[model samples]
Target: MSGHSRLVELVPLYALDALDPSEAASLESHLEDCEACRAELDVHRNVAAQLVPDEPPAIHVWDRIEAAISQGDEGEVIDFGAERARRRGNPFNWMLATAAVVALVFAGVLVGQRLAFDGLSTDEGVVAAAESAAEEPGALVGDFLVDDVAVARVVLSKDGLGYVIPTDALDTLDPSRTYQLWVLTPDEVAISAGVLGADPGPATFTWKGDIAGFALTREVAGGVVSSAGDVVSVILDT
Candidate 1:
């Protein structure tokens, strides 16, 4: 008497060995070929494995085949049903709860930012951000992801004076070459800050110079670029 049988219908009989020998054999054969049955069996086995005993038994857990066979045979069904209902309510609603929490946090940050600049005008946020950027040892060396896109975080230094971090877009590079950062000014251009490519902080160097131009362009090893890439992050501080 079957159209499409529920997996739940099979559970009690499966737990009790209630089926005849022929029926059990048929079910076993079908289970071997069925992904759904195997997955369901795996979950039940995992849950059963977690059941604890208030008083330990010396008997081997696997030796008790009756444990599974005794499944739908008792008042224990009520407890399993309650646990299943709680699990369903707990996991799915969590996504909605998390979304609401994130929205509240983002709104709070926006309000705080507005309150901070209630008196300042004309791009005060930009000014405050830049000043905050300067105070950060890493921000002044804005050599990381640009405009939310992934790129190389290059660091160049020589002779121990220190180096500069340049955020150079990697998509602009070719297969065999790399971009290099050049330190130049209105009157002089002298240090090769570094060669780009590689992430997680490029090799640190002992660099020394006034980094005026701070341009990045494609070049050969020991990088030499005639014109920098279009995605240049120029700082005209000089």
Candidate 2:
């Protein structure tokens, strides 16, 4: 892959702060002049922000951090003053510090597993499916609107794979509720696509046969076999 293509592939990892130092530096430099990549970065960042729980980090996470700090390697030596001054001088260092703290909190919950949103795993394969669908021929893209105002976008490919990317206009629900995606048939039969989390993020689903459009509903967490919630937004297969 070319430089831009390679950087584009790293966008997701960069969003997660999973990129190595050198790769991140290169991508950050490229992002300054690449509007497309910057927008992609924003989308990934938004999805990540929505995934973080609103509640404060668990107490045990803090305890673990304290324990680790107190039990530092037996012979390890560090210059705390220099490290503090360096961090103070570089804003980016502060951002990295925050990211590290957030990572620690998330580690307690995620434990190296892929995040499962609405029964659908947002794994690399699923992300690749969405990217592939976007590049495929005969792919349909449309907006899901509420009160005629667009709140989310949906993509449906010829091979029956679909992806949903929500906008900030969509409200985040409480722990008791979640957003659900449904595939609607021409006859108006609704098929469950997946249960999106309380704060809907990018999601991938699969469907076979013809679909009239797509709908999003706010349902109880864990979702329902049959939707008991009202449709919040929809995109017609026009």
Candidate 3:
């Protein structure tokens, strides 16, 4: 046989480390001259490595393997004539068995998909879904991040007066640069509330103008004559 075929034939012995030193040396030297032998040897070696399990499994995997060697994966092979006769006797039953397996697999896939789909809609997910829904206006999901980092989601209430709500629990509101709620669109500026600087957790407040007109802004402790800071948050239209 050619060197490549010889390598294939020798592969099981090489994998088992049963090759004699002289034979192994000859094979290694041959590998340098025969590229096909080297390639085939590498493939066989990789297959051997994969046969070793990564960990001690919980179940007895070797039980079936032992049985498989004595009897083939399907069953003990019958004489071809006998096998033909048996197949002829039960062709309809074989088709039914195959169909049942296919139906079971299809049901399992559908159940798995439904479970994944149901899992997507969580309590936390509901708020995002509500906001994204086509009919409803965008909403303010309150700040849950950054401890001691104060956030005020100033929402303009429907009745026109603005509510200055603290997104997080605030520290002592800055006495000097008071947090004043300002209603500002592209045009006019109006003070919703002069900075209380001490309102705890989601406080409601009064508006200087119609909430429908301008977006909201926070200014110094005492309300500002002009815009000082950015529009912290805006109630987006539904």
Candidate 4:
């Protein structure tokens, strides 16, 4: 039989230094030319290293391991792979596997939290702007919709300050274009609030005077003084 067929279980045992000297010597010889076994050995070795603590576990730990092995079967073959797959699983290895899975899950949660809150300061500003505008005495709060789909919320304070809170809809903007917010008056006049990046999150603008509502238009980067492109979305105060 080829090396892997014979040494599949032995490789993992050898990685843990649990194999006898003779068995280890034999496995080391096979490892010299068997790339597949070497890779598998490395994987098992890494997992074992990560699970083992720097400080030795209590004496009861050895007792539990002994009891687990004895319960598995004193006369059974010492094949780690077969033992893992056996009908009556070894509790010791199962505990180790569970611990490894928990460690991996905890690590993944930490990474996800880091990515989710990396822009905490910016998000704080968005929430603060929205709350502040909402609390203003005569703030006009309205939603900007496209094709009957709400994409952004516009808040206009009585002091002529405006804030735009973008939604998931802005994700569809073309990378080559910028979105510009305009304050439209009753006589059909549009005033530019400011030009925004393609996928802006939240923005604040100043409109000294306003009459009707707001409109969003797509324009080239470094937005024009006046919009000449098709309007993407509109919000009417009425």
Candidate 5:
């Protein structure tokens, strides 16, 4: 396979913050010249953002996010409740949703094994991350993948806080486009979770309502009234 093809497979995981140091370093170097991969990487990173476990701030997160974008901050959180509430609810067709869910579950199992193999308690960061997760009730965790390869993991708390833990697989995107996350409500209406980028690790955001699942799409840089890009991934809020 060509280098781009290989890197394409790794973009999702890289976005999830699941890539090891050496592998991640190599990918970052490749990204400097490969703008297509960089854009694809942004897609995966934004999709994976939904799986992170951190909590969003109380208010004006979007204000800060816009400021950060203007100031060239690496990453920033943005609110999506209002936009989500206003959008018409046409979620992905059932078959596609089911397929994505299956892939996500399969990837989650593999990622769990990888985490275990890495030695659990020895990594203080892992332990702390777990302890942090333990504080939330009805917390949901699962893997998201592209073609059965583990790319990212999603976590949501009973209170609606969320996090996306991505691995070493992801894809880059176009500079004129941005990735947007959507939360499907129990009523079947999809709500926006805000835009996403390539600055891996964890980001925090808030949503209101009974969430049924999540979706990702690429839209114009700032975002749009409705998602125009193809649905890339879906994970029903479980």
Candidate 6:
């Protein structure tokens, strides 16, 4: 496999220390520059950490494992069909059972990570996420318009994580006021997505559920729970 693809596949195994030294080193090096892979690794690591139960298994669990090991030691013909049937019937194969559970948990975590924002706090990371979202199949892309003229652009992923990129069309506001982003729902309720600075640049925010559209309003500095200011720009879902 290619470098990135190989590294991504190794992430879950790496979290469990299943990779050899060389493989681990390569994955670590690749993670330094790849934010998305790093995020995936983080998710896998978190799931692995949570796998340890608060209470230890009963003595019967250990007895079952020992019995399975003893049965493996006998020098008998290794028949693949019989082994499969044995494993299916054997309740002592706790290791295989545990592995299956871990696999299911990791699958769920990967799906959730894809839908949930990775919490990219830096400007560069936010821009990268937005650009990545723009390339996604179901991403919503549009322009924020004022008086029929475009003032800003937005790229919202299907999961509702999005970024707003402002243009020179929006003049800088006074120190006492700031640009606030509102996520409008079908009910016309305006939810505050984020507060952009007086001179807006590229910024990220997350909104759940259905979004009817988006709007930028000039509000008091630090923003407000309810907007009581001028609407600067609007972008409706088309």
Best by lDDT: 6
Quantify all predictions' global Cα lDDT against the true fold: 0.38, 0.62, 0.39, 0.61, 0.58, 0.63
Clashing pairs counted in every model: 8, 1, 4, 0, 30, 0
Lowest summed lDDT window (length 10), candidate 1: 99-108
**Model 2, residue pairs in steric clash:** 118-195
Q: Is 2 or 5 the stronger prediction by lDDT?
A: 2
Relative to the true structure, candidate 2 reaches a TM of 0.45
Residue-level lDDT of model 1, residues 107-183, one tens digit each, is: 22222232121222234444344333333332223232335442432222222333333223333332234556544
lDDT of 2 by residue, 50-165 (tens): 99889978999999667545644431221222434454543222222322111001122323432222333234555556555655566666566665555666767777777877
| Candidate 3 residue-wise lDDT at 50 | 93
How do all models score by TM-score? 0.30, 0.45, 0.28, 0.47, 0.50, 0.47
Which scores greater on lDDT, model 2 or model 3? 2
Superpose all Cα atoms of candidate 2 onto the true structure and report the RMSD in Å to 1 decimal: 21.6
Q: Write one digit per residue (lDDT tens) for candidate 5, span 119-164.
A: 1223345434533553444655555556876555566656666765
Return the lDDT, model 3, position 197.
54
Best by TM-score: 5
lDDT of 2 at 72: 43
User: Which of 3 and 6 is ahead in TM-score?
Assistant: 6
After superposing candidate 5, which stretches have Cα over 4 Å from the reference?
A: 1-31, 34-99, 103-131, 198-201
Candidate 6 residue runs with Cα over 4 Å from true position: 1-125
lDDT of 6 by residue, 37-107 (tens): 87887898799889987897789999966765565456222122334445455311221232111100112
